[model samples]
Target: MAAAAAVAALQAWFWNERFWLPHNVTWADLSGEPGPPGSGIQYPRAGHVFSAFPLALGIFAVRLLFERFIAKPCAINLGIQDSGPHRAQPNAILEKVFTSITKSPGGKRLEGLSKQLDWDVRKIQRWFRHRRNQDKPTTLTKFCESMWRFTFYLSIFFYGIRFLWTAPWFWDTRQCWYNYPFQPLTSRLYYYYILELAFYWSLMFSQFTDIKRKAAKLANYAKYQRLCDAFFMLFGVVFIVTRLGIYPFWILNTTLFESWELIGPYPSWWLFNGLLITLQVLHIIWSYLIIRTAYKALMRGKVSKDDRSDVESSSEEEDVTSNSTKGVLSPSSNGSNRINGHVGSGQWTEEE
Candidate 1:
């Protein structure tokens, strides 16, 4: 059948060894099965990577349970409450515009809607504000999200430390390239990578509804726990030493310079190193932003918000998040009817 033929062609293209492995390598060489009797070497199959996709779904289900019981109780104890938004009144006209045209319309668009519905422009605009607010994640919801991340990071940190304690590469950097891609992947390392892959998949699944900010202090900040000056200072030093120091000098040097001596350049090898270098560049940019935020918090004697955030208000800020400011209703002549206001200091704005 045409479908079967297409599927076979697609598989052939995707599984092409030339695109993934270095020259002289083939899929048979990567077989994970036991070899002839008396042979001690083990080569991991590349095909097994597909198994993690289902595992990732299982991890996501576990995360939902973990958030409900563990993270929810913790958030409640910390004074974070899940507050539901005020529902918008049913207006088919406004709702249609919201779904199809735009959630937050500019001044000109608001004027058109005002006349179309034969209602006050302010009323229509306020409806959109409340509607937008309905979609914003509650404080406790955001807290639970941060808690999940913090939990995974903390657990994985210790796990990695313990797992690598006796690794050959842990003792000598040169051991990293001893056999290169032809090396056997230990059972422990394979599971570690699969678990890591699943965790990232969980994040990806949740990202559609989650708050978009990438702040490091969200977990602590949401819990209302103020970190000590010593902790920030120590964290700053450790972050720089690890990210900017050991990363490039030790890890990058080994992968880029030393690895060349073991396995010469290949398409797949270049692609892998390209992603690695991209990550390093991101680390550099993040280093500057993170350090600056930490420095500001130190000077101000508090961690206020994400470094990228500005003053976030409900009516006004939601418009910012929606990528338009004109949704803010024009206040009364005296400006006393402004519906937008700031939340408490502990609360965060919608900015990412």
Candidate 2:
């Protein structure tokens, strides 16, 4: 609601001739018939800002469809497993116990849980193993996700450089002040802003999906921790440089401070600056969280798992899928012989 009000106020200010005109120019001068060819001014179209919302929605829909149909299937074919069967889900009480207690139960504890759930010990063990595997994303899936983000960030960074390199605001920060609200927003600028906004929106949308995969598991602790650490460092550096560095040093400085010299104090100016500052605050908060995580990694020499992650619900179906694959065996005679030998050894050990 506040955002809507701010946009509306900005629109009102943009269309107001009194706010935009120089001291000498009047509405009469602007409306005068047969004005000198060079005397007329091109007013900014405030309505263009409203177009951003629709563009954002279109981008989101396209991203959703692309991920669901194209990207997901491609990843799956590349060895990424999707959620498994629905019947693998445990009852509510068991699920709650599993989540709250140990991830892996063994010895007497495992037997107790098996008896409580009225399932065989082997089944309980398989469930725990499958649950752990579900929480760990395949290597190919991680690569695909990282590559997607890297591509977007690289493209946007270069595009921003190309667009702003020759701009007056890039050279002389005070130039942003000179035009004030009368500066028309070009198509290039509009697209740039919308794309940046949409990228962040997409990140927020997919955040939950990847949260469980962010930390390393005990099974492959060393290898996974290194990968997690490297990615975290990369993400933190990029975020700090882009959001905390360039944005405040260049964009916010010009819009909030330099522009004030020409525009003076007005509700629209304050509102716009307020929004920019609000974004900066959010960036700071996120950076703080990232820093905290980095500190923990540095001190403990490992990435700590986020316990609040929604892995419990997601692991249920994954367990079923993994268990179903266990029944399949190689058709080769050598494989059959090896499996038979293993089964014979297990039976002998059980009898002893």
Candidate 3:
């Protein structure tokens, strides 16, 4: 494959004499035949990098399976329910019109739709309502998804810090560039890099699924919004610290500024740096979107509800009612009133 060939070429170029060959050592000395006692010479292997790609794929498969079979079931047991069975699907023309134009069809528009579809106005209304509700992910589903990501990010952040804490590069970033490609990739660093890359790849793969679930209408929008805001804030902060802060200050600075002596204008060095820079650029763009959402919330004096995701009718109210009924019973009148107030505020009223 082209990719495999490219990796092979880069590895060949990286190990050439111009990079990392000591003054006394010849290419023959790198044949691993016990050069000298305690010389600490390591003949670098490019296989480690290629092997990590398959390992990353394996981990991704495991995570996907775990989410579907274990996490989803556990979430359901914790009382996360989809709003109920949807009404029969609308015809393609009707669906296209409703989604593209206006979610909430008016009196005259409803009449026109009824005429066009040859269905009762009430049936058309129900179809649109169900269509909208179908887009909103259940509370339990969102909770589990958020918890999974939060746990992964939190663990990886700490793991990365621990792994790099005692490394020479951690203390003096310039050291990363000193030996350059001659420094053999350690197993710890190899796994760390591959796992992190895999996580990002998983995110990219599931992005469409996340978008579908991000419809922003839940049984308890206020409570859910609080969770969403907190998670987004945490994720944004961690991303900035790792991708924007430490990466540029440590990794990029060393490779771009300090590594020139060892790398000596190699195309591989430029390609590798280019990839890191591209990741930083993506992080900046996502950060901007996150900040814009927060800014809009601040300016509006409330979390901005995504009206695009709102359903038109109260058919889904039963799901909210069931959720309330499952709550703990209060003995005192004051306690009952407080609980009622909270539920009332959280639930979607007829007006909504």
The C-alpha stretches of model 3 lying farther than 4 A from their native spots are 1-44, 53-57, 68-70, 73-78, 89-113, 120-143, 197-227, 234-244, 301-352
Give the poorly placed runs of model 2, Cα more than 4 Å off: 1-43, 53-61, 68-70, 85-154, 194-225, 242-244, 305-352
**What's the lDDT for residue 119 in model 1?**
77
Residues 179-294 of candidate 2: C-alpha lDDT, one tens digit per residue: 54445455567678778876666566667665333322312222455776676677678878999999999889878777766766664566677899999999998788777767
Q: Rank the candidates by TM-score, best first.
A: 1, 3, 2
Worst 10 residues of 1 by lDDT: 343-352
Q: TM-score for model 3?
A: 0.58
lDDT of each: 0.72, 0.61, 0.61
What candidate 1 gets wrong by more than 4 Å, as runs, is 1-6, 32-41, 112-124, 212-225, 228-238, 308-352
Q: How many backbone clashes does candidate 3 have?
A: 0
TM-score of every candidate: 0.77, 0.53, 0.58
TM-score, predicted candidate 2 vs. hidden true structure: 0.53
User: How does candidate 1 score on lDDT?
Assistant: 0.72
lDDT per residue as tens, model 3, 1-352: 9999999999778777544454544466555523355565455544445655566667668677766787677656656654544554747977787768647487897898889879887667667766766765555556556555655666887988887898987898667656544455555676677787777666665676663324222223324556655555555577678777888887778777777765455645677778888987887876676567666767765445433233323445744554444344334543332222236446422211
Residue 106 in model 1: lDDT: 72
Q: Please rank every candidate by lDDT, starting with the best.
A: 1, 3, 2
What's the C-alpha lDDT at position 247 in model 3? Answer: 80
Which pairs of residues clash in candidate 3, taking residues 3 or more apart in a chain or in different chains?
none
